[model samples]
Target: MKTLIFKTASGYLLPLLVLFSVFILLRGHYLPGGGFVGGLIASIAFVIHSFANGLEETKHLIKMHPGFLMPVGLLLAILAGASPLFIGETFMTGLWFENPVPVIGMVGSALFFDLGVYLVVIGVTLTIIFTISETL
Candidate 1:
């Protein structure tokens, strides 16, 4: 894993990759970008960081196991999708609520889906990192 970190001039690109991944994940519902794309982007960022910094340093950067996050994301996505059913709506139906505190419009299933995507991305990205790091 230490071998994966490659500190060099190219290392600066890591932050940008993470930012882009978030963008992809956020825009998933409105655009083509989604959890899968975002996850790949994030994974690439970390992988690049690992290459630039070294696997050992990269390991320190991660606070938790990325693989475990995958299931959490899946659960969130399922819950989001199924929530409509419990509410007497079709699967994946759109739901919204107005936040009385701020009096803001709150959207439902879309956000839930995004959450699921976020989890999936995190899990997949970690899995990739672990696999590649171990091989190296």
Candidate 2:
């Protein structure tokens, strides 16, 4: 299964998939794609690479344990949701910045929440997949 062509193709596909996933995540607020789908796409990239290059190589490429991302993402999401409380607003309230970012448009708690979801999804998914792969 580890054909040279497959390895090379997977190598190229990993970056492309990750980039596309980010694109999907960023456009999610106004479009169909979002954190969950984006994370799935990104995880699929790593899975494909692992299939071609082996688990160790894929793990090495990622540079860190996927499980670590979970808490960080949770913290981000919680912070985003709780931020409104400081301003005398309800929890999980949507708060928008005065100035919109050039490309992503209006930045807000929702975006941060979505980003948190993105990281959480990626972490959870990769953790599960890698665990299953390891046992096989």
Candidate 3:
């Protein structure tokens, strides 16, 4: 690994993949793609970078352990699902805002739940990959 071509390509690929993942996530509500797919794509980007560069360098680039994301994501999801309860709606009910957000459009609890799923998937995938790589 760490070949010149791979390293060079990965540098460009990382950002592109991340951006595409976000695109997938954002459009998932109406489209086929969703948080799970987006998260997988995002994790693949980092995995490619790790393979091209060293694991240490990839970890450095990430700046924090992936495990930390899990709880935060779970909390966000739980909150999203429970938010409707306070307004006398059922738990996990879809709650939409009056106005759509600029880029994401149609702000709702579903999107937040999807985002939470995205983060959890990314965290779990990265943690497993990193741990396996470290062991090997």
* Tens digit per residue, CA lDDT, model 2, 1-136: 9999999999899999999999999998778988888989999999999999999999999999999989998999899999999999999999999999998899899889889989999999999999999999
lDDT of each: 0.75, 0.93, 0.94
Q: Arrange candidates by lDDT, highest first: which order?
A: 3, 2, 1
CA-only RMSD, every prediction? 3.9, 1.0, 0.8
- Per-candidate TM-score against the hidden true structure: 0.79, 0.95, 0.97
Per model, state how many residue pairs clash: 16, 0, 0
lDDT of 1 at 69: 82
CA lDDT for candidate 3? 0.94
**For residues 1-136, what per-residue lDDT tens digits would candidate 1 score against the true structure?**
2242335543667888888888787777667987778878888877777677767667788767788888898999998888889978999898776652242135557767887887788788778767877896
Question: Which runs in model 2 stand beyond 4 Å of their true positions?
Answer: none
Q: Which stretches of candidate 3 lie over 4 Å from their true place?
A: none
List model 3 lDDT by residue over 1-136, tens digit each.
Answer: 7799999999999999999999999998778887899999999999999999989999999999999989888898899999999999999999999998898899899889889989999999999999999999
Please tell me which predicted candidate would have the highest lDDT against the true structure.
3
